[model samples]
Target: MKKTMLLCALLMSAFAAHAQESRQDVSISATGTFSPTIHGATGTYTNTDTSLGALVSYRYLLTPRSGLEANYSFTQNTPRYVVPGTSDNNVHLRQQEFSGAYVYTMTFKRYNPFVEGGVGAMFFSPIKDFQTTQLDVKRTTVLGGLFGAGVAYELSPSFDIRAEYRGFLGKTPNLGHEAFTTNRYRVLSMPTLGIAYHF
Candidate 1:
């Protein structure tokens, strides 16, 4: 019994020491985002917009090649009308998303390539008119999903630069409280650049 207990204690101590030596457990990143046109319909109007945005993410590595990540991003653009006489009149359309993903990474020397998939919620808000006091004409929340791929180049043991392309899928947003004449879907393509710090 005494020998067995000693053996287990020794094994536990070795594991703790190894964990300390391999401490790349947490990472944080800041990103700049660009999104191309998103198309959808609400009532009789079609919505299309391009946007520039920002994102921040936190990741916890479960292993060398696998991690869980949470991210938040915000984007704003002006929706172009498909109708002949309709005009945006300079109003801005805005979206904010919060998501969680599972990431898989492949590591080689100083470069790591990764793929991720996730689901979350998005908040949409639109401005009625740029010249008026109505900042948010309507606000709504909807389900959203994402898939992405990226490459990270390590600058040091603790920092890296990353670039990624992501696609966001969701139902078309209705800018007002009226009933929808059509239920449409939209996919927004986003490219991002960021720097990550690992600890």
Candidate 2:
């Protein structure tokens, strides 16, 4: 009876040690984002410029294959009217988003792939220059959703390099609130490259 009890205790200790070794609790990452032009409200404003942005994220592991992540991103672009005779007038459109997601990861040696989905809120503001005669632009807050997938390569026990593609869905922002209010939905695609540290 004593021998059986001793073996049970040793097995339990080994299992605990193995569980600890396989667990990764937390991770932080910094990323660069690229967003393409988006058209709004009967092509009233067609943003033709590609933009650069930045994102920072924190993730907490709930299991070996799943976790919760929160992230924030900032993006800015210049948009112009689609009319051919329109003068060269450009306005700065800035966006900031705060989000949380559920992340699922699959691992194979040094390679890890993940998929995430979440909901969030975004703030959109338009900045006009002194010479601009456009209507006053107001900062608007709207609800948004995101879906993304990524792959990560483990460089060390606590470091990784990652690449991800995320798509954001939200209402088309009406900065000027002109005559037309189409209330349409718009999508923004952002691809990011980053490095992460795990602890």
Candidate 3:
């Protein structure tokens, strides 16, 4: 038992020494959300509005090149349903995302390029106003996968400018109504640019 404990302690000490110094960063980004049009298998189609959004992220580094990031993004989206001969109507949705990602970074001089992938929960709340048809529609939340690729250009020891393309993969929300059903999984693309601050 003594030998086993010693070995375990030694291994843990080695691992701790091998880990890089911890670093943390916070970033705020101006983003654009663009969703694809889904053509259903049953002669129905759904299209989402392209809108402006914001992304806030916090990252903690466990190693020099590997870390984890938590992100929150918000936007307003309008999805319209077209059923070939009826009146076209749209649902104004307030969209929010809560996600976490494993980030792997590569550094080249003052430039750091990174890739991230993870899971997210998408919350969509529809505004039942004059633009929205009164149905049995309510709020809904969908789980999805999220990914990003980006590059950061260091300006100083404490600041960097970041540009990234992020995407979310999920099923189209129906807002609890059959008219909004597309039965399709699609991606929402976001192009982001922002600045990060480090301490």
Best by lDDT: 3
Give each model a TM-score: 0.73, 0.76, 0.86
Q: Write the per-residue lDDT of candidate 1 for residues 1-199, one digit (tens) a residue.
A: 9999999999989866764455343343444434334343532455545557787788877877888988888877665434334434334666788989999999898999999999988887775665323343477787989999999998876678988887788876655533322366767777788888766
Candidate 2 lDDT tens digits, 115-134: 99999988877766653345
Can you give the lDDT of residue 158 in candidate 2?
A: 64
Q: For model 3, where is the 10-residue window of minimal lDDT?
A: 13-22
Clashes (N, CA, C under 3 Å) per candidate: 0, 0, 0
- Compared with the true structure, what per-residue lDDT tens digits does model 3 show for residues 10-110? 99777555432338899999999998889887777988778998999999988889999999999987888876677776888799999999999999989
- Pairwise TM-score winner, candidates 1 and 2: 2
Model 1 deviation from native, Cα RMSD in Å? 7.3
With candidate 2 superimposed using the best TM-score fit, by how many Å does residue 25's alpha carbon deviate from the native? 7.1
> After best superposition, candidate 1 residue 152: deviation in angstroms?
0.4
Give the top-scoring candidate (TM-score): 3
Q: By descending lDDT, how would the candidates be arranged?
A: 3, 2, 1
| Model 3, total clashes | 0
